[model samples]
Target: MLRYLRQIEVIGVENQKKLSNSSVLVIGAGGLGSAVITYLACAGVGKIGVSDGDLVEIHNLDRQFIHAGKIGIKKSKSAEMFIKTLNPEVEIEIYDDFGKDKSLRISKYDLVVCCVDTIEDRHKINEVCFKNKKPMIHAAISGFEGELAVFDFRNSGSPCYECIYPRNIHSEKNSVVSPIAGIVGSMQALEAIKLICNFETLNHLLRMDFRYMEFIKISISKRKDCPVCSKNL
Candidate 1:
């Protein structure tokens, strides 16, 4: 309680307790995952499950600060070490290979944060979250551009990632201006905290172009033919 004294003043004791009791699964250990994991752990989230199979490379250090001095090791393990060092009171789980059974893994946590880099991975996460009726915080970054949205699958009408960007649409470029990842990733963490504390979260896609300092909030609607979420409706 003393550790979160300042935060408690803002969110109140009950909300702080909610954060302490909540569990979150962050499914990437790259740039976005770094910020998401760091903030959530610092905020005293009860349990954090980090699932990333990739190895930490020197290039990743530019954005994935949690993996600092941890090259040549799996990102999940590195993240676990960082969280333990930052806040041992917060429980940590490491998943080196989450591809085996996403549904089983996702079902164990209260909320899912999709920090993975690729569009394909996002769709897979979206499908599984919708199936489990779990809330998901999704964000993506490329160069100076980034976007974020929350799909509360617990609500039947919530629009999912697929509803906004269909499977046919693909993006493989990983180029990103480093600070952009930090900015957007921090927002994802805030959104996750808000969702856990039962506060209002972003219901629309927030697109930002840092190079131009422009932000756009686009309303999202469920696609009647959305293969992931609409079927459930």
Candidate 2:
């Protein structure tokens, strides 16, 4: 209680307990994964699963603060180390491969957070979440722009990731502004906590252009023929 005194003040003991009892899976261990994992663990989520098949590199230091000073170490292991250091009471599991083969297990988790950059991986996570009726929070950042969306597959008529990007959209190989990763990733963690605590979320696609100081919430709906989500419908 002492550790979460400030958070308890905002959400109260009951909601905090709800957060502590929930489980979440975060995919990717890059810039976005760094922020998402940090906040969720600190917020007292009971069980956290981190999956990333990358190693910390010298260049990743710009935004992957959780894996700092651990270059050459596997990112999933580094994230587990950081979480254990920040909140030992929070149980964590690490999976280096978070691909379609393992996505089927996502149903066991209360929520899945997509922090990876690739649209293919996001679609994979979305398919699993939709098939298993798990809620998912998705976010991505590129340069000074980022977007976030929450899809509660447990709810009827919710939009899935494929509904927004119906085609294979590849991100340009551009360097992202370091802070934008933190901003967007933190927002992903916030949305997950809100869902666990029964708080309201945008429940729409939120696009942010930090360079222009602009934020827009675009309304989205389920695509009746979405190859990924429609099958579940």
Candidate 3:
């Protein structure tokens, strides 16, 4: 409680407790995962599950600060060690894989934060969260550009990840300016905190283009004939 005193002053003790009682799953351990995992732990999220199948590489050092010293370690384990040092009050679980079948476990948490880059994996996460009626925060970055959206499956009517980015659409190769990952990941953590505190966030697509230093929000809607979330309707 002492560590969270300043934050409690702004969000109130009730919201602080809410954060302390929530569980969130972060599915990535790279740039976006580093920031998301760090802030979520410091915010005192009660339980955090980190899943990643990659090992820390030399290149990952640019943005994945959580694995600063251990270059050969698994990302999930590295993140777990950082959380233990950063905030022992927060409990953590580590998963070494992010398979489509493994996505079912996402239902066990209050929220899921998608820090992965592949469209296929995003669709898999969206499917599981929608099926289990859990809200999710989605973030992606590429070349000083990033986008974020909240799929409030808890609402049952909000558009899903697939709704905004169709499966057939091919995304360009992943290329990111290191700082953009931090920017987008921090936004994901902030939005997750807001969600836990019962606050509303952008329901539409929020895009950031650092090259032009411009931000944009575009309204989005669920596809009535779509396959993913329409079944829930």
Candidate 4:
């Protein structure tokens, strides 16, 4: 109850207890992933699971704040080390693999935060979450831009990730500026916490342009033909 300084009286004591009992799985440890992981740890989200095959590189320091001075280390391990210091009361889990390998298995978590960079993994997480009937907090970043969306398959008509990206359009690698990932990744953590804490979220997509200092939301509707959500529909 004392761990959540911000939520203490605003959400009351019982809600804080709920937060302490929840588990979340975050699927990246890069720039955006770094932000999501840090806040969730600090927020005292119990039993967090983080996965990333990336090793910290010199270039990641700009926004991957949790791994500063720990370059060349596996991101998941490095993140886990920092999380230990932030809040020991909460248990942390780490993984160094791709998100798609066992999407359904990973979806067993209470909620999923998609901080991984690639669209394929996002699509995969969306599929598994839909199949497993879990909620997904989706986030992505490139250059000075970023986007975030949430699809709680537990709810009817919630849009999946594929409702936003086409298969042909998402085949290539993406370009990312350090802070863009931070901005979007932080939002991912925010959404996940909101869901865990049972607070209202935008529940759609939010796009940000750091260069112009603007943020906007694009309404998303479930696709009846989306291969992932079609069965559930």
Give stretches of model 4 more than 4 Å off: 99-104, 170-173
By TM-score, rank the candidates, best first.
Answer: 1, 3, 2, 4
Query: In candidate 2, which residue pairs get closer than 3 Å at backbone N, Cα or C atoms, i.e. clash?
Result: none
Estimate every model's Cα lDDT from 0 to 1. Answer: 0.93, 0.89, 0.90, 0.80
Tens digits of per-residue lDDT, candidate 1, 108-218, equal 999999999989889889999999999999999998899999999899889899989998777577999998888999999999999999999999999999999999999
Evaluated with lDDT, which candidate comes out highest?
Answer: 1
Q: What is candidate 3's lDDT per residue for 136-163, written digit by digit as tens?
A: 8999899878999999988867899888
- What candidate 3 gets wrong by more than 4 Å, as runs, is 99-104
TM per candidate: 0.98, 0.96, 0.97, 0.92
Query: What TM-score would you give candidate 4 relative to the actual structure?
Result: 0.92
Q: What's the lDDT for candidate 4?
A: 0.80
Q: Candidate 2: global Cα-lDDT?
A: 0.89
lDDT by residue for model 4 over 159-189, one digit each (tens)? 7888777566765446777767777777788
Judged by whole-model lDDT over C-alpha atoms, candidate 3 comes out at: 0.90
User: What ranking of all candidate models by lDDT puts the best one first?
Assistant: 1, 3, 2, 4
Best by TM-score: 1
